[model samples]
Each structure stands twice: as structure tokens, then as C-alpha cells.
Target: MANQLGIYGEQQAAQYFLSRGGIILGRNVRYNCGEIDLIVQMGGEVVFVEVKTRSSWDFGAAESVTPRKFTRMKRAAAAWLEGQPYRSVRFDVWVYVVDKGAVEHYEGIDGGAS
Candidate 1:
């Protein structure tokens, strides 16, 4: 059930980005450090996205992204960029509320240096 919800949330988030003129570069990118839910390019910048989903906001879905998780995300993003051409990169988070069918995007999420 949790996996299903996560997949659904990712799908919704992908569509949301596409509608807003973002190009999907990759999905479910995994590395020894961690996993990136999605990679997108918009306005000449590459964005590594983390998607968190919940049935309700009672527990604050986005708040689940702790500092440790952020560290892992940054490492994962770095791994993703290792072989790619240099470009501006940033981190983002997409919080999806399943019950509300809504998504909230937070851009330029900082996790210090990768």
C-alpha cells in the first residue's frame, strides 16, 4: 500500500511538473548514497526532486524529510551529476497529500554541500 501510494504520488508530481513547463529527465534514480524520486530540467537548470506522500497532513508529509535524509539526497544528486555535463542544479521537494489530491512544491531546498 505504501509503495502504491508513493508511485501514484510520483506520477502526479511528474504530471504537475510537465504542465508547468518542466522536462522530465529521469525517475527513480538510485545510487549507493540514496534515491532521487525524479530529475527535471527547467529554464536551463537541473533539479533533483524528492517526493513525499501522505494520506493527510496531520503528520506533515514534507516534514518527514529530516536532515539525515537531506544529506543522503544531496549525495544521491551528486552521484547523478557525476558523469553529466556541468549545469546549474538544485534540490526540490514535492509533498503530495493523497486525500486532498494536492501537491506542494518547495524549490531550492538546501542540504549544504554535496
Candidate 2:
């Protein structure tokens, strides 16, 4: 059930991104130690995106990506870029909140030094 909700959230985010002129590059791309939720290109920038989905803010907001998570994301981004054909890259986070059947997006949260 949680996984399904996550997928739904990611789908919603993807749609939102596309509508905003973002181009999807990859989804659920995995490396040996980590995974990237989505890879997108917008305004000629390669964006490594991490999607966080939450039912509510009881624990915290969806943008709350821990340092460990950022580390893993960075490692995955490195692995992804090693085989990619891009010269520039950036890290972005998409926070999805599922509220009363509505999906909200908070895009481009800084992951720090990734």
C-alpha cells in the first residue's frame, strides 16, 4: 500500500514537472548503493531528482531529506553521471504531499553539495 502510494505520488510529480516544461530523463534509476527517483532536464540543466512522498506532516514535511539520504543521492548521482553524456548537473528534490486526495509538489529543494 505504501509503495503504491509512493508510485502515485511520483506519477503526480512527473505530470507536474512535464507541465512546467521539464523533460523526464529517467525514473527509479538505481546504482549499487543508492537510487534516484527521477532524472529530468530543464532549461538545459541535468537535474537529479529525489522524490519524497508523505501522507501528512505528522513526522515532518516531505522536503525533510536527511543528510544520509542526501549522501546516498549524491553517490547515485555520481554513478548516474559516470555513464551519462552531460557536462553539467544539479540536484533537486520533489516533495509530494498527499492531502485529502490532492497531490502537492514542492520542487527544487536543495540537497546540498551534490
TM-score of each: 0.92, 0.82
Which residue pairs show collisions in model 1?
none
Give the number of the best model, judged by lDDT. 1
**What C-alpha lDDT do the candidate models reach, one value each?**
0.86, 0.75
Candidate 2 lDDT by residue in tens digits, 33-77: 799898888877888877777786563444367677878888988
Instruction: Choose the strongest candidate by TM-score.
Output: 1
What value does the lDDT take at residue 104 in candidate 1? 84
lDDT against true structure, model 1: 0.86
| Collision count for each candidate, in order | 0, 0
Residue 75's lDDT in candidate 2: 90
